[model samples]
Target: MHQDPTENIVEILLSKSTVKQKAYRNVCRAFKELEQEAQLLIDVISAKTTERDQDIKLSVEPVSDQEFHIRIAGDLLVFVLHTNIISLPEDYEYNKSNYVADQPLRKYLGQINVYNFMADSFEFNRLNDPGYLLARLLINSENYFIVEGERQIGFMFKSISAKPLDKVDLDILIKLIISQAADNDLVVPPFPNIRKITVREKLEKTQSLGAGNKIGFQMSYQNETKS
Candidate 1:
């Protein structure tokens, strides 16, 4: 008995969608694991480096279903996981020169983007600040991925065709990337025209009754001060 062409097409579509959904879930799992480990690493750094008055903080926040942020030191690293599966173009260098599993004509991938966020952009809730890509993950399988980004991260996996996320080496690589990101200072003095001065009143006690101390307030500008 011949199956209906329409039914066959429907089955194919459902199968493809199922594969993509599975891929998305896998990417999410990998991301969650990475987040947990990375957060722990940052906590260790904070415990080691924080001072009496100045505390070093590292935070992780989920901005959306597909996006989250890792705030390390004073900078923010945004991680965005794309839900849609994508295929490499035929002319792409990897497609042409790399070793593929040889199972399918088109290789589908789930993508994860790592972005740098200026402190003010995230803290102040400003949308105008532009972020640049710090790293990217092309996730084909739950455990296998290709990384592309800055030298600090991209160099770790340069020799391998694809890296396994579950490997111990990946944890080390992630730690290195986070440390490098923390060292990458993104904060700077705001523009002179846009900067503002904040004034706070300070109460001072009279010195030894005879020697009077002039009570004055403190005026602090961003990274600057004038009495």
Candidate 2:
């Protein structure tokens, strides 16, 4: 006997919806854990640095239900959780891994993105300043997680874990992110690029002048191509 098409559609919808709901819930729990861990870490750092340089500032600010900011001295790291649950593409390396092969639902993920920006950008209200994407954490319904990120964060966390990320794991991840952001120094823009600003720009958008760690790399690449 053939099954009814309507019933098959409903079954598929319900199954997928259930998986997505579970993934969303897992991500929300993970995010809350991350926020708590970050706050605790900040407190520890504050206590340790009490006698250190007075200029060094550290704080965590919750921006919203799905976002927060961690300010460490000259750097600002923004963490944003995507509201949607998504599945990795079939060709994605992680999707092909044995971890996901064992259970296809593990491929579904909720993403949390981390961005790095200069603290001065926000302080000076430089809306035009660029922020770099430092890392993204992907968590599945079972709480298994992985990170795709820059520098050490990339290589160190390329593989998906069999277990959920715990407090220790989160602490290490946060420390690494802070280290990466602190180490990435801002560079002066190329002289030619900044030498020809109009009077209006100098008066109005002076603070908006592009500033970032890798700001000049693209311009230099373009110059090289033209040459």
Candidate 3:
């Protein structure tokens, strides 16, 4: 019988041995596959939603987080997530500037519910929409982040998951997390910047993007040793 890889993952974590490394590699491999699936999904969904672009009239600068802040040419749109969620820095401001009093980053980043999005949508829509599915890169991976076009948008995980402790905390929680064994299916490698490769590896392999925009992140993997 095929056991859940997550069980193997937890055991590997619990056991300090070479098997753990192999398990970690397996986890990364799994995330990489999921990431690809997510991209395909974006392409498919975007094609369907393009026809409704009458209200979408903002410059797409291909900004960080794969998000682009829209001026709407000439109109006022009080922005919020698909949910009755409040605004984040990325949700508003024309550029990347903190908005919540002195908090700087206090944006709400909700998951991109594909099921809900297909049913409901913001009147004005474009590539860099204000939902999870719109902004996150490596969505199914641990390195996943809430992509935002505007700095006005705060971190999204804070509300759905919990509040950020600091920049460090902000960074950690933003990406994919392992709440349980199944979540390991999406957990990214090295957990953080720590890695089998160095920062240079990241710069070389990864396309760096700004605060709210997204750049692709290819999770790394080690080969499982054959017994």
Candidate 4:
């Protein structure tokens, strides 16, 4: 009853490939829905600002098939859908959860990364400025999703068994992301880090300054709320 090695390899490949395909499709669908939701949120915010005669710049721009950018005031949130599917590490918390344990195939997921950057970085063409990863959205073949992020974003959407991702969920997520980004303000770099700069650095202020919301601070997930 020994299985042929070639046949076994082919069978495993076929099964995993199918799972990857499904996960990719689900991520793509979620990305499209997110783009639409983001635009809707921007419109609502814009309307309110207009009502109050306030100038709050807000817009959503699709950068590519896999990426989009949402500008809310001084912060820019970039959403990028990864083309590849991935499996959770063995020790990852999701792997230990009953959701994935019940169906091991659920471990395979596609990812969409959310990054926060200072709008001035792109506006002023500061190529060396850094962008912080605010959250990662993981979607499985079944569209069951989880968000790994800072603060409320990390804890609020931990459940994978609740339901498939939807417009309402996206709206909530977009608001949380914008709130987190806006709450974290840019701070000056420590004296030691910027005290000793070369003459060349003085000439290239934009690149050498390395501006970021948490430029000289600890950016660990556990330390996010502390700041």
User: Residue-wise lDDT of candidate 2 within 109-179, one digit each (tens)?
Assistant: 99898888888889998777778788788888878787777567765675776567788878888888888
Candidate 1 vs. true structure, TM-score: 0.69
lDDT of 3 by residue, 123-194 (tens): 333323323222322111122223332121223332121221233433332222211111212222343443
Q: 1-227, model 4: which lDDT tens digit per residue?
A: 97669988899899889988998999999899999988988898889888876767789999999999999888889999999899877876677777777778888999999888888888977777788888888899888787777677866775563788888888899888878887878887777787687777767764436464532222222211100
- Worst 10-residue lDDT window for candidate 3 reads 112-121
Return the number of clashes found in candidate 2.
Answer: 0
Instruction: Give the number of the best model, judged by lDDT.
Output: 4
What would the per-residue lDDT of candidate 1 be over residues 46-137, giving only the tens digit for each residue?
Answer: 67667553556667777777877877755677888787888766665445443444434225667787777665555655544556667777
Taking the candidates one at a time, how many backbone clashes does each contain? 0, 0, 22, 0
Which has the better lDDT: candidate 1, or candidate 3?
Answer: 1
Taking every candidate in turn, the Cα RMSD to the unseen true structure, in Å, is 14.1, 6.9, 21.4, 4.6
User: What stretches of model 3 exceed 4 Å from their correct place?
Assistant: 1-15, 54-227
lDDT of 2 at 107: 78
Better candidate number, 3 or 4, judged by lDDT: 4
| lDDT, residue 225, candidate 2 | 8
Q: After superposition, how far is residue 118 of candidate 3 from its true place, in Å?
A: 20
Query: lDDT per model, in order?
Result: 0.60, 0.78, 0.29, 0.80
**Winning candidate number (TM-score):** 2
